[model samples]
Target: MPEPLDAALTKVRELLLDPNLTRAVAAGRRRGQRPSVVRAELRPVVLKAGRRLQISTSDGSRPYTRNVAPGTEAGAAVDALLAEPFGNWHVETADATLQLRVTKSGEAQLHRAAADRAGAEPSGHDRTKDYLLDPGDPIFAEIGGSAAKRRQVDAFLRALAATLPDELSGPLRVVDLGCGNAYLTFAAYRYLAQRGVDVELVGVDVREDQRRRNTELAERLGWADRVSFVAGTIADAVVEPAPDLVLALHACDTATDEALARAVRWRSRWVLAAPCCHHDIAAQLRTRPAPPPYDLLTRQGILRERFADVLTDALRAGLLRLHGYRTEVVEFVDSRHTPRNLLIRARRTDGTATGQQRAEYRDLVDQWQVRPRLARLLTEDAPGG
Candidate 1:
């Protein structure tokens, strides 16, 4: 498979074709929930309005697309949203919200708009000048983002930064397990710092070669002051000033479990793990009796692989709850881009784990007839009360 694009172009014509990006911007901002917005050059899409179809700018003047569902509240929301003057419309569904921004673009044209705004004093650029394209800045190109998409990612990262604790903030200590090439660690450090968040980061991997190259890159980024690397197996190494946030991106199977073990032992406030390769649990699942209605799912290899993912994350979530952490298993990004799509963001809950939590976990494992790699590892040698 081709290397996944860390970001995508902001050209409206090109982006409209990517189903995942469309869904994300739409789902992100809708009525009655956090809003999702997108910025793009104008491209009017025509929609059938009963007997006649009208093609118009997303002026909100034309009614919502026919795909929009019906209901009193939905109708009211749509009407209210349309009254606003926007080249793009914000659509809010029951579970998703997206924004569409449409504008015309060109370099000289943008500068003209910015100059126009500056003349007004205490002013910002005219709407036409707000765009993702800025030939002057190359970071946008290197990072795979248009200025527009970078804004979206920035918003998401800032939100994530807020959700994690302060310990993960000030001189924010971080450890990235399996930090091959260290691109993400680089992104995180830059993202946080740009937002005035101070961070000290460490990238861990078994490959001495990768560590050497990454350390060189760190120095070049001027992060040599706060960032460094330790060469060895993640399990074998230990970090001083225990990290406030621990990330193990695509750590294979039991390796993911090991990453989690390290975070939990340190009792780190935040744990982010995008687990990859369910080969271990899939092996155990081979012999298990299928739960009643799920028996049919196991018959299909594709479905079985899918089931392994859900079952594994579910068990992992339950186990986290049992160990006093609040967890969310959410779409880290679109599945179309990566098979390892689910991100487990766990925050430590101060209270002790309740007996009910333990009982529920046991019940879930019994029903799945499979044990999670993390559960098996952590439960062993757990202190007897």
Candidate 2:
């Protein structure tokens, strides 16, 4: 009923040896395995010495890569990986595609298909160098992270990179608010620095330990002169020379509001935030009745929480518009990696909100009778108030 494991392994070997093999990825770790490698990928590479097969493996957070001649120990290691009860194998060659899934009963199920006609080479970011955080970096190895964490960092960087304006002149000043652990802070510094952009980076958090540890990390990376950490609340953190870019990743609830308000106050050219926890609005919704014709919106606790998340972000985006900043709310990472993946990117623009935009924002707030923290923070001294 199923292909023999040896037969599947033989096919894998053939594919691995094929010069036309574009990419081969093995994922889903076997239970109770040593080294804890969760995923691996094989790709052909041409080195100065000669052609080699590059094997990249991720032990969850950290990624490592090595190359070896075909039919050597490295090749045997790749073959052994196929025999493991890894969940899935996806292989792509110039002419054919192979998909294999391992069943709980240790049987191999294989599927084959014609390779889709090649299109323009797919556009992609280099996972290692393009990101602020690289799994292959010494910092990641020191901190101990997985492939998934690396993906999250890459996703966030991709979004931020997309929002960056083309015009640039001088050193970029960046402030990371509520930068707990400062993983992304360090990453931002690395990304900008690698691009030959002069960067002045500061990470702000409430914890003194985090500040001290991040400061140490910066010193180790030889970035102490340019990148430093401070211990303070997002609202009170002091950044000198005013930041051109303000970043807040997963700042919880009203804290996110504080970060945005701080950015607006500084007139920062760019603001990127990934808000976490909609507790404040969710709490407010519990005490207030929903508007007519929309009572079903918050009928169930789960639905109420989800609605609060959307309402909170929508209001935040609207308020950004009201403040003359173009804004977008986008997914920061795959939902499987983290549910709190929404990123709000705002860029200062010459345009301001129209009368209708302001009226709609006001109406929504009035109808819901919920005062968003961001609105209150941004509009505390506005005309109506």
Candidate 3:
């Protein structure tokens, strides 16, 4: 049922000022016009002297933040957010979660549910701030991601949190394809386990040493029963009871193709991949002349390399859409954290390739005169392949 907008806003302000407030998030533009910040969030933080509410805003590419004292200051901040044309608002306290949505007709629809507990305090990029991944996890001492790696893991897990289903029928089986060092592998397991999720995870790496080291770490952490590592290639790794989610982070060059191909073949429900290099497509671009007048695009070594990265990922996304998956290419983290920051997040859907889609893909490949490894791996029997 819809609630009075003023009433909802009042309740939200109260929650924001409450000392128990865990988090408050506002997303999407309600007015259908782009806002200065794509997303904004507020959470309670404990300072050395006292408690305060921290507000963080992200403009899709970067984040800016500020801290306000509780009571009037926090309420004013909350009012400023409510005044914005954000489509959705969610607030959580120690006891309950409240959600508000603005309808097309300007009605306020609200929902409430019990919350389990206080949210985890993630390790913040700034020494004084909090982030999405807790910095003090025991695994960090062994796996080591507290510094530079923290941003990558936090960004990846934030996507996973949003992608995971609201409810689960049984244990979630996850496979990390080409999980070299397995930093993310351990982080995922620990995060889900802490949430009381019945999750079983497997990390596959071609190197036997990595597998052994990860296995030893898992055993030492008392997670060997639920988390395991395998010494095998992403293309040939045998994960019993095919995974519900597949993660391929930083698989270099065409190795990423191999991982995506394997995930599509398995019909995994979800896939999150962060490609490391576009060497295959870049090398092909160097060998062939750019299509017609666009020759200027590839005339320079640096420009050609950057263009190949864009073209390669675009083609990869188009291919995934043709393969019955809803695909989105997103920057999971800031480029400063890692140059290879593009993450391909896909969810299995009933989408079918239309004649127009197929034609466009074919036309693109013909114009470029370059065969992407992903296309060749996925559509070997197709005409171009």
Candidate 4:
């Protein structure tokens, strides 16, 4: 109702129109108002014609999604949503994150942080952040295929930022289990280092050749001391002093379980994992009969495969919750770049799981008639197991 409130709404409109917008979330209904669609989200998508804004809303039961072309059409849609009784708004762009909260008196409080900043050359030229990585970056030149990889990195970093601790007093310790070529590994290190964070990063890969190559690359980049590599399996990787953050991108099948289990064992503060395939659950679904009424869910091979992916990640998040972690499953990238875009981001809550949580997890497994690899790993490693 005041300047802050009006200015905040104006900024929200500007964000909706900004081409660099990554994602925006509007949540929390104002007091005395009950909104059907409690949460609304906006993100960019690639279309055959051009880039469009994808709008998704949830009514606490199901989600409705649609896309609108960028420009006046998107602005109109955003105006309608902003006129709703939402009390909170969060926006992420290429350069920063902005949060606006409305108080009971209708006063808006706004906070802004430059989470992602562009780099500049000594010659007074700015290094363009096409995604998050500059196209002329040496890392891309070394790896090849800069455009797609940059988008993937940008998406992954967005998810990572959700779980990163706010109070970072000391150096951040990180481990990338099954890091393969370590594209995300290097990207994480570079991004954090740019933000003035002291990072000690380790990348673990099963292939000795990969470890050597990545280690060499780190040295060439003058990051040999901050970033290193080890040759080991995700479960067997020996990382001393543990890690504050764990990253496992596209670890195939149950290997994701190993990485997650290892992170729990280390009591890592944060974790971001993007799973590649769901063969373990898919294989089990093939042999087991689907639960009653839900049989149609698995009637087709393609549908069964897709359902297995959802079930696998849902179970994985449930297992993480059991181990004193608050977890969320989010889209790590636009589906156009890769279908394997779902990411499991978790933070250590250090709170015990309630009996109801355990029972619900068990019920889901029983109904599905399948055993999850993550469940076995967490159980076997628990105390008295």
Off by over 4 Å in 4: 1-131, 381-385
Ten-residue stretch with the least lDDT total in model 1? 106-115
The per-residue C-alpha lDDT of model 1 at residue 334 equals 61
Tens-place lDDT per residue, model 2, 248-287, is 9999889999999888888889999999999988999999
**Residues 1-385, candidate 1, lDDT per residue (tens digit)?**
1111111112322333322221211111122222221111112222453221111212111112323322443344333333332233332222233334322221110110112223332322222223222212222322345544455344335436655654332456889887776666666765555344566788998999988998876543335556688887767665787887888877888888888877887787788888888877677777776889878988777788888878888788877777778988877656655567778888898668888888888888888777787877786774211
What does candidate 2 score in Cα RMSD to the true structure?
Answer: 11.6
Which of candidates 1 and 3 reaches a greater lDDT? 3
User: What TM-score does candidate 4 get on C-alpha atoms?
Assistant: 0.66
Candidate 4 lDDT tens digits, 1-385: 3446877899878977798887777765555564556567788888898899999875532367899987788988898898987766778777777777777687787878974544533221233443554443335534554668777877877677667855567889999999999988987876676455678899999999999999877654446667899998888867887999999999999999989988998899899999989999999999988989999999999999999999999999999999999999988889887898899999999999999999999999999989999888877845310
Q: State model 3's lDDT.
A: 0.78
Candidate 2 Cα outliers beyond 4 Å, as residue runs? 1-134, 381-385
Better of 3 and 4 by lDDT: 4
- Cα-lDDT of candidate 4: 0.80
Model 3 TM-score relative to the real fold: 0.66
Q: List where candidate 1 sits over 4 angstroms from the true fold.
A: 1-159, 165-170, 381-385
Report the candidate with higher TM-score, 1 versus 4.
4
